[model samples]
Each structure stands twice: as C-alpha cells, then as structure tokens.
Target: MVNPGEVPTASVSDLPSQDLVLLDVREPDEWAAGHAPEAVHIPLGELPARAAELAELPDDKPLYVVCRSGGRSARAAMWLNAAGIADAINVAGGMKSWHTEGRPLVGDREGVPPEVL
Candidate 1:
C-alpha cells in the first residue's frame, strides 16, 4: 500500500497550474457537489479505462489525484503509477483540505447534471 506520508506533498497554494494535473477521483455525485477548478473529474473507478483521455498530460508533469477526503485518490495514484504513469501524486487531504483552506470550488450541491455525463 502507498503511504501518504512517504510521498512528496503539496499544499493547495503550492500546486502549480501548468506542472500538475489535478485528477478528481470522486464519484459524479461528489464531483457535482463541488470540485476544484483546476481538477479534472475522472472518478477512481473509471481511470483505467479512460487512461487514453489523459494523454494531454505529459509523462513528466505530475498528476495530483484527489478525492472526498484522500483515501480513494491515494489508491488511484498508486494504480496509475503501476500502470506506467510515473508522476502520479496523491493530494494528501483531498477536497476536505481544499475546503479547510477556503479554496473556491464550482459545482451544484444538488448534483452533476445528467447532461454533463
């Protein structure tokens, strides 16, 4: 198992827009509830199948995976790394940290609309 403390960590403020891809692994319902603007909603379960869609991200640029409170994203990052994406990094605190730090988010509390699917 990947340990969060063993990897390099980045605070929300430390995240660079160009050097990182914020991959949100939360479900559609959670993503629709709110997500960081810099984040891409991939849902943990869908990542393996959707790997091709992430080609825009260079192999060198780190992918910062995040979820509701961090668990899922950490696992997703591990899986991505095993699959050959070397720079996958799990955001330690997930969206909970973002909210704790007062970062702004966009989404509907009711849920992500079906049209966005």
Candidate 2:
C-alpha cells in the first residue's frame, strides 16, 4: 500500500501527455475557469462516488492528480492510494505552477485567458 504523505510528485513541465492519466480534482468553477485540456474532471468532492470510473483507466499508466494549488491534490492522491490506486501521484505546485510555466489550458471564461482561480 502506498503510504500517506508519500505520493510521488512531478513538476508540470515533466508531465507528458501520452504517458499518464491526468486527473483534475478541483471543483467545477475552478475547473471551468481553466484546466489541462486532456485532464479528466473528477472533482475531489466527487471522488468517492466516482471511484469506479477510474477502474476503466489503464493500470500501466500512473494517475497524476492536480488542483488549484498542491494541497487538495495531495489529499486526493493519498486518498486514491488508500483506496487502492497505488500509482496515484500529486502534481507538485498544481495548476498555479502549470499556468506560470505557460502550459496550455482548455477553458476561458468570458474572454478571460485561462488562469488558476
């Protein structure tokens, strides 16, 4: 079992699109504001109810979890590991870092550019 507080982490730059499952755990408003286009939206609050949805993902690929900052994603990663998704990892610095690094984001609200809320 993966230990709590020991989830693996990687910077946004290190995350390549083809290799892993990007799980965005932020809430709806935060997600709608901006998010990695390829990321799967399973808000942290809904994870318990949607845990089974993750079973369809390939086991060979690790699950990279992200939120507005690192805090919520870290909790989500720990919870995922505890719930038997052993390869879940927290995206260090989260969307804030992703935005700062100039990574592409999907949604923009009211003509505003995509940004971490």
Candidate 3:
C-alpha cells in the first residue's frame, strides 16, 4: 500500500509547462470533458502494450499520472515504476480535484461525457 505521505504528487496549482510529462490515464470521453494542456492521453488499458509511446520521456524527467479521481492513475504510476519508469508519480485526487479548485483544463467542456467520468 502507498503510504499517504509517501506518494509523490503534484498539485494542479504547481504544475509546470515543460520538462515534466503529464500522463492522463482517463478514457477518451473523460479526456474530452477536459484535462491539462500539457497532459497527454494514454488510457490505462493501453499502457502495458504501448510502453513505447512514452519513449520521449527522459529518465530524469518526472512523469505525473492522473485519472478521474485517484485510483487508476495511481495504479498506473506504480506499474510504470515497476517496469523501470520510476519517475512516474500519481497526482492525488486527479482531475476532479483540479476542477474543484478551478484549475486549467483542456479539451471539451460541454459536459461530462457518458463513456467515462
């Protein structure tokens, strides 16, 4: 289990523009609702088979993961770390918290898409 204090996380307020890679594991619909501008979409189900998609990230560059809340991306971060992508970090509370705080988000904003939220 992840120690509450030990999980490395980045608040939406503190996110930087470059260097770090923001990976969003939410499904396409959720992504359509909104996400971070710097974030890239790579749904969790595709991560294992699509590891090569992240070849662009440097070992020293931080990798931040987020989902609708905190669950999926947290697991994805752990998985990435186990696979030697140790820089992966789970952004606690995910997009919901970001939105709650009125943080910036990208993509569609019409409503929460039905496929994922």
The TM-score values for the models, in the order shown, are 0.78, 0.88, 0.78
Which candidate ranks first by lDDT, i.e. highest?
2
CA lDDT of each candidate? 0.74, 0.86, 0.77
* Residues 1-117 of candidate 1: C-alpha lDDT, one tens digit per residue: 556555545666667745457888999878887888777788888888898877776666788888877788878878777777657877777888877777667776555431111
Using lDDT, rank the candidates from best to worst: 2, 3, 1
Please list all clashing residue pairs in model 3, or write none if there are none.
35-106
Q: Where in model 2 is the C-alpha error above 4 Å?
A: 1-4, 108-110
The alpha-carbon deviation from the true structure for residue 20 of candidate 2, after best TM-score superposition, in angstroms, is: 3.4
Backbone clash pairs for candidate 1 read none
Instruction: Supply candidate 2's per-residue lDDT for 65.
Output: 94
Better of 1 and 3 by lDDT: 3
Superposed Cα deviation of residue 80, candidate 3 (Å): 0.3
Clashes per model (N, Cα, C within 3 A): 0, 0, 1
